[model samples]
Target: MKATIERATLLKSLSHVQSVVERRNTIPILSNVLIEASADGAIKLMATDLDLQIVESISAQVEQAGATTISAHTLFDIARKLPEGSQVLLHAAEGKMLIQAGRARFNLSTLPRDDFPVIAEGDLPTSFELPAETLKQIIDKTRFAISTEETRYYLNGIYFHVSDEGQPVLKAAATDGHRLARVTVPRPDGADGMPGIIIPRKCIGELRKLLDEVEGSVAVSLSASKIRFGLGSAILTSKLIDGTFPDYSRVIPTGNDKLLKIDPRSFEEGVDRVATIATEKTRAVKMALDRDKITLSVTSPENGTAAEEVSGAFQGEGFEIGFNARYLLDILGQIDSDLVELHLADAAAPTLIRENDRSPALYVLMPMRV
Candidate 1:
C-alpha cells in the first residue's frame, strides 16, 4: 500500500486504533494493525485484541490500492514524533513497510494482511441513538463502582438495561458487593425491547475515550451476544460478557426512614479528616448522628482515634454506622449538588445516598461492623 497522509490526521486515526492492540501477544499478527488504501482516496486502519476491535477511516492521497499489516504502536509513535504539518508517506516494498516523513525514514516488519483476524458482524436486533453527553454521564457516574475481582466475573461490567418504571428509562448500574451505583436517563427511541447486556470493564474504558469532547449522537447496535458503537468515522465492536448480572433492583434499599441532610463538602471534609487515624487494613470510619449534629470518628488499636463533628438536619432517631472511608468519599465525589441526603435504616442495614430529593442517581453502601 502506498499513501500520503498528513501527520496530524494520521496520528489522530492511529491513536484511536492502536490502543486495541495488546502489547504482548501469542500470535504475531494480533500485534499488528491492518492498513488498507483504496482507490477512493481513503485509508482504513483496523486493530483488535480478540474480544474487542476498532476500525477507523481517514482521508489520504492514495498512490496504489493495496493492504498491509504493520506494528500499530511503532507506527503511532513515529507519526506522533514527526514534525507538525509534515506529510507522511507509507509504502510497501518486498516484505517490509516503509515510513518516510521529511528526513526521517524507517523500515518496519510487516505481517500478511490475510493473517489479521476480523471480528465477525452479528445480526443486531435492536438499535438506538444516544447523545454523547448523556452516554458520558451514565458511564462516569457508575464506572467507579465496577468490580475488579476476577472471581466474580459477573460483577466486573456495567449492566445496561431498560428500567421497569411506569415510563421507559435507560439505566446503567455497577456494584462491587461493598457499594452500588445506579443512574437513569430518559430512554431513546427503538430501545424499548433491548435486552440487558453486561459490557466488559475493558470495553467501557476504551469506549469512554471515544466519547470524550464528542457531541451529537452515537449510533448503537445491540444483540443477544454482541454490541457495536459507531462514533463518527470510527467504530467499536465488543463481545458481551457471558455471565448473568445479579438482580440489582433488589439490592437498593426502599424503606430507610432516618434522614440526614448536610452540605456535601462539609461531610466529605469531616470524613477525610477523621479517617486519618483508621487502620490501613480496615480504613473504616464510624458515623454518630444526633438531633442536629453528626460526628465522624475512626478508632484503631495501634493508630489511636480521631473524631470530627459536622452540623446537619436530622429526623427520626439517633443512630451510628461504620463504613469504608474511601467508599464514602467516592460516592460523595460524584454528587453535583451542594447538599446530599442520607437515608438510614439502622447501623447494620445498607444506607441510601442521593445528591438531592429528586435526583435520578442513587448510591447504596453496606455498613461494616466497626
Candidate 2:
C-alpha cells in the first residue's frame, strides 16, 4: 500500500488513535494501527485495546490502494517531528513499512492486518442524538468522583439512568467508603426507555477529548454490552461495565438545616491557605459560618494553626463543619458561579452544595471525622 498525506493531517489522526493503543501489549497486532487507503484518496486509521477502539479518517493522496498495520506511537512521533505541511509518503513491503517526509526516511516493522481485532457493530436496541456539549457537561462534572477501587468495579463508572422524577438523568458517584460525588444531567428526548449503563472511567476520559471537536450533535448507539459514539470524523466504541451502581439518591441530605452562601473563589482560596496547617492524615479544615461571614481554620498539633475569614451574603445560624480541603476545592472548581451555597443539617449530616445561579449541578460532601 502506498499513500501520500500531509504531515499535519496524518499527525492529527494518529494522535487521536494512538492514545487508545497501550504501551505494553501481549498481542503483537494490538500495538499497531491499521491504515487503509481507499480509491478516493481517503486514509483511515484504527487502533484498539481489546475493550476500547477508535477509528478516524482523513484526506490523503493514494497511489496504491491497500491496508497495513504499523506501530501507532512510532508513526505518530515521526509525523509529529516532520516539517509542517510537508508531504509524507508511506509504503509497505517485505513485512516492513517505510515512511518518507522531506529528507528523512523511516522503516517500521509491520503486522498482518488480519490479526487486528475489530469490534462488531451489533443492532442497537436504542439510538439517539444529543449535543456534544451536553454530554461533556455530565462527564466533566462527575468523572472526578469515579472510584478507583477494583473490588467494587461497578462504582468505577458514571451511572446513566432515568431520575426518580422520570427525567432523563446522568449521574456519576464514587465512594471509598468516605466521600461521594453525584452529578446529574437532565435526560434528553428519545432516551425514555434507555436502561441505566455504567460508563467506565477510561471511556469517559476518551469521550471528553472527542466531544471537544464535536459541536452540533453526536450520534449515540447503545447495546447491552457496548456503547458507540460517532463524532463526525471519528468513532469511539467501548464495553460497558456490567454491574449495578449503588442507590445514590439516598446519600443526599434532605434535611440540611443551615444554609450559607459565600464567594466560590474566596471559599476555595481560604481553604487552600488554612489547609496548609491541617494534619496530613485528615486534611480537614474547619469552617465556621456566622452572621455574614465564614471563617476557615485548621489546627495541627505539630504544624500549628491558620485561619482566614471570607465574607458571605447571608447571616444564618452559625454552624461549624470539618471537611477535607482537597475535596472542597475539587467540587468548587466545577462550579462556575461567583457565589457557592452550602446547606448543613449539623456537623454529622452530609452537607449539600449548590451554586446561586440555580444550575442543575449539586454536590454532597461527607464531613471528615476530626
Give me the candidate number with maximum lDDT: 1
RMSD of each: 1.3, 1.8
The sequence of per-residue lDDT tens digits that candidate 2 reaches over residues 1-370 is 9999988889888988999999998888999999988989998899998888999989999999999999989899998899988999999877998999999999989988888899886777778787888888778777777888999999888877766555546444555445566666666666667778888888888889888888799998887778999998999999989998888878888877677888898789888888877777759889887888888888898888889998986545677889989888888888888888888888888888888534767888889765
Q: Could you tell me the TM-score of candidate 2?
A: 0.95
Where does candidate 2 have its weakest 10-residue lDDT segment? 168-177
What local lDDT score does residue 219 receive in model 1, on the 0 to 100 scale?
96
TM-score of model 1 vs. true structure: 0.97
Candidate 1 residue-wise lDDT at 323: 94
Q: Which pairs clash inside model 2?
A: 168-187
